[model samples]
Target: MSTLQIGVLFGVVTFIALFSGMPIAFAVGGVALTFMLIYMPAETVGLVAETLYSELDNFVLLTIPLFVLMGAAIGKSRAGGDLYASLNRWMGRIPGGLGVANVMACSVFAAMCGSSPATCSAIGSSGIPEMRKRGYSPALAAGIIAAGGTLGILIPPSLTLILYGVVTEQSIGKLFMAGVGPGLLLTALFAVWVVIRFRQEKARVLAGDESGATREILREEGFTWREKFETLPRLAPFIGVIVIIMVALYGGWATPSEVAGIGAFFSLLMVIVIYKCWRWPDLKAILGGTVRESTMVMMIIATSFLYTYVMSYLHITQEVAQWLVALPLGKWGFFVAANILLVVLGFFLPPVAIILMVTPIILPALKAHGIDLVWFGVIMTILMEMGLIHPPVGLNLFVINSIAPDIKLRDIIWGTMPFIGLMVFAIFLLAVFPEIAMWLPQNVK
Candidate 1:
């Protein structure tokens, strides 16, 4: 069969497996194993073993579990509550203040916990209801959280960025640096959108209110200077954790793994000290979450490597690359097409799987087009962020639905739509001015 035919068959079978509800790791591995046996019959076992072992045999991979642990410790505990509560008190005095505060909290939490669902869950739990109580429409409240949570992958110490760097053989630090600008930009955009959306919702509420009950709900119960300052003590530890992580990365004080460990340890200590969550159940929940997430990610990474190896051995990736480059489109046109495909793929696959499986196949074409890998990493991370809030596989959407079951899934999806547009606009801005993502990575030591 032609390499094209084989590649088509490989993708069809893999998608079928995935849509049929098979786990991603097993599905990818199964298709890969099947193809390997068909192609390398006698050498299938050896090839699979070798590829799997070599791909994961990196010290840097340890950072995944440590990062997961840190997020889990904070996310599974009261740290998220503390983080959100403090921000809420400070931001609650103004119109749409809760929403602006939610965006800020999500951005800071994203830096600490590199998991999108975790950030969504951690922030959404309190943000949504509080917004609801404060007369923020349920859909808008849900949307703020579902969208803000996506920052987890675009901020530094991001898992998706780490995986992208590893798959593309780019510097993890540079990828992290590239993300900082876009991350902050997206955060600001989310906040701005929240303010706009809040005003719209407030107008509707005021117009529709027959009684003053709705107005009362929208009323701001002001916090005193002392009350706002009281939250600072509760929030300082989480801030300290973020500062430590930033210092570790930008200061060149430690490797990624070391930073992950330090962040995890401190986050754990904060929960235990503040929440007194030293019970075995608390520790067990944290460790259990860490192990499950780490194992799932690692498995997907391994299977994706096996899938890549199969494609490479069959010359499918090279053939695809040649095909992509031969298209009549110029580099910018190529980017538009590639971004469309990545966004579509993001709708179906998790960022880690896409980073591992799709990146290898596209790397040659990307290099041929003179695209910077760090910039592409940030761009792809934002695309994946869209996926996190988008439907079908929109983890953050479901996370919001779970947190605020009173809010319908459809409404939650609607809520996140505006934020999705903001992400697309962010992409457009980056395309027009590449420096938005490149300046930090280029100028930083």
Candidate 2:
């Protein structure tokens, strides 16, 4: 069979396996192995072995586990709660204030955590309840938290960025820097959406009320300065983790892997000393959780490498690269096509799976067109962030729904529309002003 035909068949089978509820690692690995055995010599075991070893051997890959551990530790600590509380107090006076706080807090939490699920859980647990207490609609609260959680992956120290860099041979540090400005921009956009929505809701409530005024509602929900000050110190440890990781990487003090290790070490220490929340048993649980999550991520990386190896061996990647470049579209057209394809794929696959499966095919095409890989990496991360909030298979939607059971799925869908619009706006902004994603990386180095 032609390499193009083989690539098509492999993609179809893998998509089927993914939707069948099979583990992604096994699905990708099994599909790749099947094709390898059918098309290549049995002696090709070395191919799989080398791919697996090489994928894991990268120094940058170490950042995945370290960032995951740091996120897990902070997710379980009191800092998340403190951060949410402070944001609530400061932003709560506005209409939909608590809902606004949820988005703000998630942005803050995203800086510390890189995974969507952890971000959803950490910010949702604290912010969701507060929103409910403030009389915010459940659907609105859930939608905000779910959509906001995606910021975790778009912001710096993102594990997804690390994985993309490892697979595409892009600079992970530069990718992280590229993500910073776009992440902050999206966060601000979400905040504005929350404020506008809050005002509309408040207007409805005031119109419906005969006895109570808006002032009464404000009096009841306003946060005190003392509440904000008390939570200030709790933010220190989380800030420390971010600073250590960024400063170490940008300052040439440590490589990404070493920074990951250092970040993890600091995370553990902060949980124990600063937060004073980890007992021996808690530590054991944290370790166990870290191992379990890290194992899942590493397995995906290994299997993705195996799949990439088989495709490369089959010359599929090169053929696809040629096909993409041969299209009528110029560089901008190719960029548009790629983003559209990724968004469609996002509807079916996990972000990591999508990154692994597609980057091998797409990166070569991108390089051939002289597209900046660092900028592309940030764009890809933002696109993945959009997928996290999208319906049916959106991971962040499921996360918030699970946490707030009373929230109907439709409400989650309806509530996300404005934020989704903001996300799209942010994407266009980045496209028009590439510097939003490129400036930091360019200056840092």
The local lDDT score (0 to 100) that residue 364 gets in candidate 1 is 87
lDDT of 1 by residue, 218-309 (tens): 55557889999999899889888888988888788988889999999999998898889899999999999999999999999999988888
lDDT against the true structure, each candidate? 0.87, 0.82
Task: Write one digit per residue (lDDT tens) for candidate 2, span 3-32.
Answer: 778888877888888888888889889888
Alpha-carbon RMSD to native, per candidate = 1.8, 2.7
Instruction: Please give the clash total of every predicted structure, in order.
Output: 0, 1
| lDDT of the structure predicted as candidate 1 | 0.87
The TM-score, computed over Cα atoms with residue i paired to residue i, of candidate 1 is 0.97
The Cα error of candidate 1 at residue 263, in Å, is 0.9
**Highest TM-score among the candidates is held by which one?**
1
